[model samples]
Target: MAILIGTRDGVYRTATVPVEDAEQVLDSGDVPRVQTFPELDGVFAATKTGLYRSTDEGQTWKNLNVPQEEVYSVVASPDSERLYAGTHPAHLYVSIDDGDTWAELEGFQELPSRDEWHTPRHRNEAHVRSLGVHPEMSDRVIAGVEVGGVHVSDDQGETWTERRDGVHDDVHHVLVLGADEYVASCGDGLYRTRDAGQSWTSLDTDLDHRYFREAFELDGRLYAAAARSSPGTWSGEGGADAILVESTDSGETIETVSYPGGPAEVILAWTAVEGDVLAGTNDGRLISRDEDGTWVDAGMIPAGIRSLEVC
Candidate 1:
């Protein structure tokens, strides 16, 4: 299959399409900040209103209804039949039939709160930032709230348990590196929980900055992106200069993948292409790392990207 690349500055920019004009879409009125799915055959993009699907390797896109809610993230269960999406107003949207239709997961409206629920710094916004769905157990899903710590749903979102024990409550992202083992990007930095969400032990001590953008594993190693925002570097340019940290044993130990460039750009929204393990930088660049943890520039992508994932 020949890959054809296109360019878009903000919206649907590039397409490595085939001549057949299969399913290729990236257009206006569509805010696809992030895309990922359990079914690697299709890339599910998280848009402002709903999710989009592309079966033909992003050659084209089709919208799925999920109006009025901002889709922060989406994940396909390892079980295949179940799909999960986290959206604003703190709702865990679920779909049982591929990417057809979605329903609000039961009891999603019942997450515990301090009566006045809001994000730590940005009190106006309250949303689930990340989701850690256990690969072996579909019923057990962990959700990271803006500043409300982590919430666990044992019955597939039917009922929830706030498992912030031994872990930071201001959780941004939760990644299950293995069965019953987890890691969270939280207020106190990187923390790991061995027995599901029951308890945790902090990793990478005193790495200040509560903002942990995303987490994923490559070649059996766990990786996460962090940024230190400032005027010229952070917020967008220099402010976002952060260290890309990795762990060999489910976050037991830490190391830096920091090379020449910094990760101020939203790293998670970019697609982590399986072959090159490409990571999209917020500064409009595509970088890839091999199994040996070496970094090299691959290309450039759209600006204002959210994160990267494989289909």
Candidate 2:
């Protein structure tokens, strides 16, 4: 058995695993979004061409015609046999009958002023950076656009509404635990909305001028990754660096963890296992400063880690 991985270098690597392990991978390839659907006894990865599925743990592959240029984010529907993906240059694709075929989500694409794509430093349409699916409601999904803020989908990806009622204009990451509970990472800091995004309050905690990047829920607490703001910025840290913060009471209070990195740059994108949190830093290293206070440098991935999904 083996686990498959695709890299930005345009190569796919496979890792061998024991048969006793239920989640073993036999192979992997040049895919962007990796997802495991055990019921189908297969793994799916989305790339520039389309979606690929492997019935035997990625030993071989078949294409599922969901054509697009750059598939940046992918999500699975819990309510039915469907898949959703967000692509570069502003496009959302939905597959209703499994991953075999897809169509451009007209409702999501038809959103008002959505055609104006913009990145952190560039402008175009809305470039979705990250995506989230509500835990309690499978039909509810949200996307974090680089410059367009937050977008929410109440009926899967069929329709999307801007979730900017109380959010900043630039949103990078979003996590929705329930209908009334959502967490967002923006250019300035972190904010949480308890009233279904109708009203929001910024968590007035200290983060050393870091722009909140990624967030995850572990042990009933929320942990977030924040990078120091770029030069000439005055949000958190004054340079292009990053750090981590943990919150136990939703978004009320936070505790900052001081990881040993320098003034140059920093990013903490990780692959979270059952009990392990492995992160790849921007400085070309893979290390983890876990909640248990035992920092471990597992080795290195030698690649820029964009985000980590616990699959």
Candidate 3:
């Protein structure tokens, strides 16, 4: 199996799974995320430059002709033709034609707290950092904006309901665990809700490290990647004090997984393929844990990886 890697510089593909070396497949500037849509025979790349799509399994790409700014996240509904894209400067758009065209979900910008959705760094502009969709509910869509808040739309992207009742506003990623259960990773800590987004409870309040980048589930365990502080404080000397945590009780209690000795760095992205959980670190290290519970270096990329997906 081959895995697609979206990095700070470009997009690449490993020679093979349990990869040893990778080759740059697309030279798109700063690919933050890459996803595959089998329904449209498409491989989509969301980059700092713009959104691009390839129907030929990433051999070549064509601009979808939408979103001139950085597309932070992109997702497609399981049971509908609706496709969503979240961009920097905090905007949301929906595509019904497999990304051929899109319509801005204007209602998202009219939220009551929209004026307060601003980042603390880099021009004080927030971005839609992540998105989540439930396969069981076609109309249910969730968006996570960096330094903003998490919002959900039950009627597709037509309208949204924003809430910061429990979770912090500096959201990075959100995942629908099951049904109404949702988990959010934020700059403050990790939070989860058993009753959908109505209410949430902090799961990582006891952990000193607050910054989290990504979370995913593999087999029957929930895995999260965390850092000691924000990326701005991370340096090359020691990298970030990054670690991986596992929760067996669905984010209720977590235990730190052992790591190989090295200067700590944040694991910004994770993915599971063929029952193997893989992580990409801020120092461009592709690490994996074996059945024996040992962390081993799988491979490395030229630049820090932002996202990983099987294709």
lDDT of 2 at 147: 72
Candidate 2 Cα outliers beyond 4 Å, as residue runs: 1-7, 10-41, 46-65, 120-123, 230-239, 260-265, 289-291, 309-311
TM-score of each: 0.80, 0.79, 0.95
For residue 28, model 2's alpha carbon misses the true position, in angstroms, by: 11
lDDT of 1 by residue, 177-222 (tens): 7667777876457778778778878786756444565577766777
Q: Local distance difference test, per candidate?
A: 0.61, 0.61, 0.81
Decoy 1 TM-score against native? 0.80
Number of the top-ranking candidate, with TM-score as the measure: 3
**Candidate 3 structure quality by residue, lDDT tens digits, 1-311:** 56888898888887465666788888878877887755556678999888888766566788776664788888888854888889988999888887778899998998888888886594788888888787777688888888788888888888889866788999988877776788899998999987767899988877878898778888778998788899887886767877788988887789987665333777888887777888888777788879986778887778888988876
* Model 1 spans with C-alpha error above 4 angstroms: 1-24, 28-33, 36-41, 114-116, 120-123, 206-210, 229-238, 263-276
For every candidate, C-alpha RMSD to the true structure in Å: 4.5, 5.0, 1.6
Query: Better model by lDDT, 1 or 2?
Result: 1
Evaluate model 3: give its TM-score. Answer: 0.95
Residue-level lDDT tens digits of model 2 in 1-311 = 34344443322333411112222232222334465543344666655555566666565677666566566567776665667777766677888777767888878777786755575474355556666675477777777776777777888778888767677767766766677688887877788887667777887455575476656675577777676674345234434556666678986888866554433445545445555554544543445656676555544444433443333
Give the worst 10-residue stretch by lDDT in candidate 2: 16-25
